[model samples]
Target: MDSDVDESLDIIITNVVATFRTRCHLNLRTIALKGINVIYKPEVGKVLMKIRKPNISASIWSSGKIICTGAASENDAKVGARRLARYLQKLGFKVSFSDFKVVNVLAVCSMPFAIHLIDFTKNNRSIASYEPELHPAATYRIKHLKATIQVFSTGSITITGPNVQNVAAAVETIYPLLFECKKFLGK
Candidate 1:
């Protein structure tokens, strides 16, 4: 059997939202008309641009800001961002792929066994919130670690937060608690 870190849990980045300082105000309509696979929603004032290499969706705003999503890695996100900058530059826009920042990191992992969400939430009431009415799964907010993990009965965990720096710490902190809440014999 593989180790816990390697088998029981695998941190798979699902989506990475990255932002860059283009420093050039954009016209969504113009870019959309010039861009490929671009959708301009003037009502929303954002142009949705899709690229194939990194397979990301870039929301270009008129305020010189771009939000790139659907990337599974930081490098992929940056690559997609730079590609957008180059595309804009090609359209005669002053673009700079500077000040790149990862605004949000969303990842998922699965435990070897199922988790008793009710019991886990009850035990960690101070740090967890079970709102099945609002959400299909239980949302656990570990504020101290700057992470909000959505736990499902299948032992699948969706971890979301603004600080990627705390990811390792949050995973370490939660794994032990998850073990305690593990449903026995695949119950």
Candidate 2:
């Protein structure tokens, strides 16, 4: 009877040790897979913009400004910038160019999105103003445009100027293509 009891105890301990060893192997495998994924991932360094609706339109003006119109909220305007950044990156334009040239982005949510243009040239730096009358909120200068962003009841916006034009055109082309991407990603 004592021998029978000892045999049962030994079996139980062996089973427990086997189970722990299996679990430890699985944990190590998981960690290895994660490290491999990080190493193999592509280096696609581009800015991303997310939007709730695809209601915006973009155009590039002759003054080299890229304009995005139809952002209904401040969030929408931010999305516009993000989208523009990605578009510029894909076109082989340096990310720094987008950062340096796009000095300001203004969003106004009125009947039409009223986007003010201010040149970021050294001599025209004064055009970018944070005045209450010119713009209720602070404004920043991007390249050759001064931007003020506001959310209005209306959902239409027009972006104009030469510098803004190229960027706007690129955005206009990319937004539609990205429409399905948003749905597929469930974003």
Candidate 3:
């Protein structure tokens, strides 16, 4: 964590999405989802299973691809994936939890001071896109951190990207820039 933005910054892990390849073909239409905490939604063409321990929902498709979401941490995501895989195996499917990957991690935090999003976007057009009519959140695509920062007028930000390790890096990178923008706007 950088000292500049460490004072008033609070990062909360909202969700961690993970993907794991089971390397097995599943027949969603014919598979018996009985005795498991799963609901087959025909409209969505997927079986959604909820894992209580890690607190995540696993969406199983006919392709044997599983998407685990709502895990609070990376480890929880992995555990959630494993839990889903084990449950499927018990249901008579040859499953493997190999190639597990974290798709994206979402975190929310607030800035110490107010942000002047309009002015910030104008001065940093190359890094930001702010079209209120199109989208209320001003998005900043920081390449180095490989994160998309959605900044709002209320100074609260949503950071989404592949690497959760970059959360601190993101705070360090954006907070100063936001502060400078606020100062420039005499806020």
lDDT of 3 by residue, 1-187 (tens): 2565557677898999999988999777555445367788889888888889999998888888889999999999998899888877887789977899998999998876667888889978998999999988899988977888999887889999786888667867888778766532342
TM-score of 1: 0.89
For residues 24-55, write the lDDT of model 1, one tens digit per residue: 88878789878789999899889999999998
Error of 3 at 187 (Å): 6.4
Task: Assess each prediction's global lDDT (C-alpha) against the native.
Answer: 0.83, 0.30, 0.83
Native-to-model Cα distance after best TM-score fit, residue 96 in candidate 1, in Å: 2.0
Instruction: Residues 1-187, candidate 2: write the lDDT tens digits.
Output: 2342222111000000000011111122222243221222123321112223434444332122344445543345445645544544454434332332232233212221222222111223453343545544333333433322221112222232223333344334322322222211222
For model 2, the stretches where C-alpha displacement exceeds 4 angstroms are: 1-54, 61-64, 97-187
TM-score of model number 2: 0.24
Q: lDDT for model 2, please.
A: 0.30
RMSD of each: 2.5, 29.0, 2.9
Candidate 1 worst ten-residue window by lDDT:
1-10
In terms of TM-score, the best-performing candidate is: 1
How are the candidates ranked when ordered by TM-score, highest leading?
1, 3, 2
